[model samples]
Target: MQHKTIADTMNLTIDFNDIDDGQFADVIEKIRAERRALLKATQEKYAKSRAQKALIEQQKQRLRVQLQCLYGAVVLIMLSLGWVFSNLEGTTPSLDEPGITHRTIEMTRDHRLDGIQLSQVERYFTAKFLVGDWRFRGANVEGNGITIHIEMPQPLSLEPHYQREYIRNSLCPKGDSELWLSVEPANLTIHLYSDHPSRGQSALCAS
Candidate 1:
């Protein structure tokens, strides 16, 4: 009876509970592995996208800087051009005034000497004076036995040579004539009555 009971119990039930447990464990492991792989792939994609975005932002910043630099350069150039044009416009002369001017001269002689020879007088004048618009308005001179008065158009001042070559050349030659002047800023009315006809023929004064 005991042997029979054992056989019957063994044969009575063959439960599939163990197989169910093994199958459940395998499914859980597979799900976990898939989750890990998916997470890794997502991380890689996110990192790549972040790097690309950073590069694009850097390029944008560089372009912005270049554009700003170009704009600044253009502004500076325009300012320089404007200044040049303004100076050029201001330097031109007007048309209302005359181009040339002239003057007259008066002469005198000493009274203490009588019967003065017409050729016995000898004199010289020297000056470095500022120039004016009219002749005697700005000039300087000194000498014995002669007096002079004259009107002029330019100042007695010396003009710049290299810069104003055309104007400097236009003035009468100096240093060669005995009665010449380095123009100044004054008007002296005097007499110049020379007894010497030979001296009268020479250059008495110039502007």
Candidate 2:
């Protein structure tokens, strides 16, 4: 007898009442085999999809680490540049306009004279001021001391102020003894007498 088989997309329904036992067994085995093959194919496809997802996640993690490193390097470079600029700002001087320049000439204990002499002080001031392209205009030797004038190619702004203190400290190394110092600005001149009795007396006794 012939069996009626209802075929669907993924399964077959057999009416066993009209079929022989041996044919029915054969059809059942064929269906079981098809089911096993389909299940195996489905498992392989799922495993491949899982592997692809894992590879994509790994790539994303690597990219994230690289971006973090790049950002850190950029920040470090910016900090370095800021430090360099701050240092430059401190050292660099403003040159908006020409400023006054001045210097003080004084004698230490090692270079003290018994009596203050204008000519000798003038020579000392001249020698000190006539360095590094500085033109010595002239010296005015008065009863108190001498005032030496100087000329420069450019108007002084920063260096002279610092040099004034440095020169004072260097010339008056021996703080105990009295010393005569002449302060002459680029535009004005002043005579200063030492506080020591000997030098003060000599200045007062000068004709």
Candidate 3:
């Protein structure tokens, strides 16, 4: 009876050992699930870091584009100012014939004189007088050459009457009519004259 009892106890111990193996399998499965969760968390962290890096790179690219635009604008402004200054420097006046010639003559107006002596430059001798900025009543040929009758806006004594003419030609140089009047008035009278009309002296003026 003692030997039978010993055998039964040994069989019961083997059965318990088999049940413990199944419990160990469940623990191993749980451990595997935890490892998978850890791996997913790590992957998510790496993805977030990569996204941040890409965003930072995009910002840098935008800043670079803006900087390039500002540099281009500065260069363009500098070039434009240089061009304007160069043009201004080239327009300075120099010593040359008809560079800007002004000749004023004195004339005593009298009815016995019958004509006013008009002086002209060689370039304007045969040229038609385009009534530029000169204030004049009438112009015609008198005794010697072309005559320009000047009229003042206010009745002022004759310091001297000036006859003005501007010659227009293809090779005509650029000039301002500033020499004609010191101060510009509201109303002015002007007349056109050409010496080719009368070869001989007329009752007006000689050319």
Candidate 4:
């Protein structure tokens, strides 16, 4: 019984050796096609994974660029605001300090006065009065005279008599021209009248 079983097993093993060439060729082609299909699928999967990673990296780079731009813009805006506030602080005077009163006065220059005379008059006031919180308010030119307004803070007082003498000695010197100065404390108005034979012009006074 053992010898018969061995003979049957040998026959089954040798049966594959009798396969025809056409059948073997077909089997080999089928296996090659399956392997090609599997290789193609693996290649496609790897390519897709790589593309997704590239897209994700691109998105991260774009986000980083946008964040950098936003930070730079924020810094520029902050610097601009700081500059504006600093300029405002420097130009605007504080009102909390005592004896800091706002006052306005007008100084008129006769059109007949030459540039030298005009400069002298300007220099005299700028040197003596335009100091210690005193500032030029504004100026206007009308008709034959130029009017200038000035503001003085607390502790700075413009005495009319002293200013008259100073102007006469400093500006008119040897000339027969007279400098008339009048002050109205209630209205904060100062009228400057220049009486010269060459120029008989009037300075319109307003506060």
* Candidate of highest TM-score: 2
**TM-score between candidate 1 and the true structure:** 0.33
Where in model 2 is the C-alpha error above 4 Å?
A: 1-12, 91-207
Q: TM per model?
A: 0.33, 0.39, 0.34, 0.37
lDDT of 3 by residue, 141-201 (tens): 3233333333223332322222222212211222453312321221122233232222211
lDDT of 4 by residue, 89-157 (tens): 322222332222242111222222322233333444456555566554323322334333344443213
Expressed as tens digits, the lDDT of each residue in 1-207 for candidate 1 is: 112233343466533364466565654465566667778999999999999999999999999999999999999999999878534432121122122112111111222221121111111211321344323211212223222322344333433333134322433235464333322221222221123212221123233
**Which scores greater on lDDT, model 1 or model 2?**
2
Better of 1 and 3 by lDDT: 3
For candidate 2, give the lDDT of residue 63. 100
Q: lDDT at 16 for candidate 3? A: 38
Show pairs that collide, candidate 3.
Answer: 141-205, 142-204, 142-205, 142-206, 143-205, 143-206, 144-206, 144-207, 145-206, 145-207
**Candidate 4 local distance difference test against the native:** 0.43
Candidate 4 residue 175 Cα shift, in angstroms, is 25
Question: Lowest summed lDDT over 10 consecutive residues: which window, candidate 2?
Answer: 198-207
Write the number of the candidate with greater TM-score, choosing between 1 and 2: 2
Each model's backbone clash number: 25, 0, 10, 0
C-alpha lDDT score of every prediction, in listed order: 0.37, 0.44, 0.37, 0.43
